[model samples]
Target: MRLVHPLSVVRDAQDWTYQDVVDIVAKATKRSADRRKAWKWENWGVEPDAESQAALAAALGVPLGEVHRLGWPGWLPDGGPVRTSFPWTMAGTLDALDDTLEHAMPDRRGFMKLGGQTLTLLAGQWLSQTPDALAAAFAGGPVDEQLVEDLESGLPRLRRLEAALGGHRARLLLDTELATVTDLLKQASYTEKVGRRLLRLNAELARLAGFASFDAELHAAAQRYWTTGLRVAHAADDRALGANILKSLSLQCYDHGLATAALALATAAVEGAGDVTPRTRAMLLLRQARAQAACGNRVGCDRSLSEAETQIARSTTTDDDPAWTEYFDPAEFHAQTATCYADLHRPRLAEVHFTTALDLMSPAKVRDLATYTIQSARTHTALGNADHAVHLLERAAQLAASAPSHRNTTRVLTARAELPMTKKDPKVQRLDELLATLSA
Candidate 1:
């Protein structure tokens, strides 16, 4: 889960034979990389010798000494097809779309290990990319504008499904939808206008799918989906949505305790959010605040949160914001801000924002409500309000049971474990029994 060998990413992109790497290394270094050694080098946790690694690096066009600095797979290309690396182009986007469609189900590895170089490269590419040539038409079934619009209209419903069910239950639907769009892109012909819209739709779908995977805690799937989404955004020339994807990736990193990488992605998201609405900008800023808090940058976190509050108020009056961002109203802003305070260990302030978030949050946002409820319970525990804390845990447990999310289940367990009086409090003891059933 941590170290994805370059053999997979590069071989898939270049259609290299299994022995190709062995041959290349042998040719470069005149070293013995036999079949067993090559097999270990390509697919497992085994580290190749320095000389062999150098030879492979050379073959991949990586700097020779990079092997020593990054140490094995860290020095390898991004954890994706090499062609989709950077300087976004139509060809790269198309290849990503096709690859996404082909692999609707990535291996659900338990951890996400996005290298620093990969994340940095993607952010740089998004910020630097401008309109390239439109993709040439493909030879497949004919696709009309009407079908594309119909798909576009249905996107909101899918988003709702993901929000309600979280990624575990909803990713299959999103992936299917993504596949349909990819089919249209690759198997049909359309006008440039239609093509652009289709690409935009695909990009959004990929983003949703990626987040769903993240929500479900399928880390590898999330990385693949998000990376593909970023590439599709480049094709559609939609930096706003691309920035959102970057933020999503940032959240993934932060949740996994990758503060520095998370900060990098969040910084890029804020910087690359070009010409977005006030609300959208607020969303990006809020994300930056969260990343800053994760990085222990109290000053930066406070600054971003202050700016985000000002922008959220203005975003309310505007009607031109993207539909995917409709969740970032006043209620969600409090929830997000509360998240930052929780990270900063300002339990009292976190309680205030969580309370407001709970009051203003719509019933439809079950997942968000559940998340805030659990965090609220923790804050109450810190404040020595055991009874109130137990009450919140009860509500959070209800939401988790009703929704059936492994991620939420894990949260419920963690929250229960953190309760100061879980052993002595009868209500908490009963809660532990209930928790047993949930975990089971």
Candidate 2:
């Protein structure tokens, strides 16, 4: 997910197509427009002159230095300093994460990768329940069952917060709660059975944090947290949880347009989900459909989607599903099907599914409504319904005014960018103005 150039930040921030930036740069620099298309695709790199760099900096509303780093071209500061210094204990892990958030929170380029030390720490947590260590650690206070129960009870509410307020608002809160839970795990000693449960809960917390980070577009941070969650899940021997995390990673890759990587990951998710509940299986299949669509595998996409729907129809509540599996429902199936159709450019089918999903969505799920509206609008725009698309876009804007998820914001912007209208179009102009004020 590393960006090739700093200008990619502008591309992401403004939701501008690469061609748009190339044209702007060409016009501003009085350069040949003939080279713009090739440059846009980066078939070959074009070294920007001083004037062109200045124009790009001004156009992107960033400092010139930020627009193009000299000598070495990377988001990282020169010489790559060590990002972690804490020990391998639970308290040390939390401290490392706090330090990570401080340095990486403001800029995606600054997000730290999971270093070897952190992996060693998680491996130690996995080994801590060995017979010799368990007997020796009888000195600490016994693990409190009540604290674990309290943490478990609050998860659904935290999930609801993520749904309503978006991941930008929930990431920090989830991290705070994770820190508290880790503090408990550090202080409270328990038997192997209790210890395993605690680790499972910690894994869930880390997975949620990763999910929030992914939604907020802190991509590298998301990867780090997701990998940490995977390690924790393996430590806990929670195959279902691990599969779910891999599915999330697949979705992230699909969103980034890495269809090949996404397909492999989604396939791995399905393969790794041994003896999974039906609902979880269906969700994984839906993710597989998305990845297939991204890869231009029409037949494979349709087959996977059919299997997903059939599995959804057969799913039942008594399937012994994980708590996270509760969120997937008939409406979600329809919404995801709409996404698959949208990707395949089957606009008519996409419109039908998106409309039905929207109708089924509860008003309480404001973020879902907003996201679906954007999806439906994209279908409409593809089908040559500019006015209808604009109408839906306005509704989406209203819904997003209160809850601005970075993921949804990017979707809306990309959809807006795809409209077959000139800059002079009033609706297009309005969208441009509206986007200028939306939170990034």
The best candidate by lDDT is 1
Model 2, C-alpha of 146: deviation from truth (Å): 2.8
Every candidate's lDDT: 0.81, 0.70
Which tens-of-lDDT digit does each residue in 1-440 have in candidate 2? 23334445446556766667667778888776554653543324455566656666667565667746642123222223324344444444445555444443344532323333443333334333221222223345777677668778999998888877787688888877777766655666776666656767777877788778777777666765665565556555677787787777778777767787678777777876678877899999999999999998999999999888788777876788899887787778899999998889898999999999999888887888888999999899889998899888878877887776887787888878878889898877887777767743
lDDT for residue 402 in candidate 2, whole number 0-100:
76
TM, every model: 0.81, 0.74
> How many angstroms is residue 369 displaced in model 2 relative to the true structure, after the best TM-score fit?
1.4
lDDT of 2: 0.70
Please report the TM-score between candidate 1 and the true structure: 0.81
- Candidate 1 local Cα displacement, residue 380, angstroms: 1.3
Q: Can you give the lDDT of residue 242 in candidate 2?
A: 72
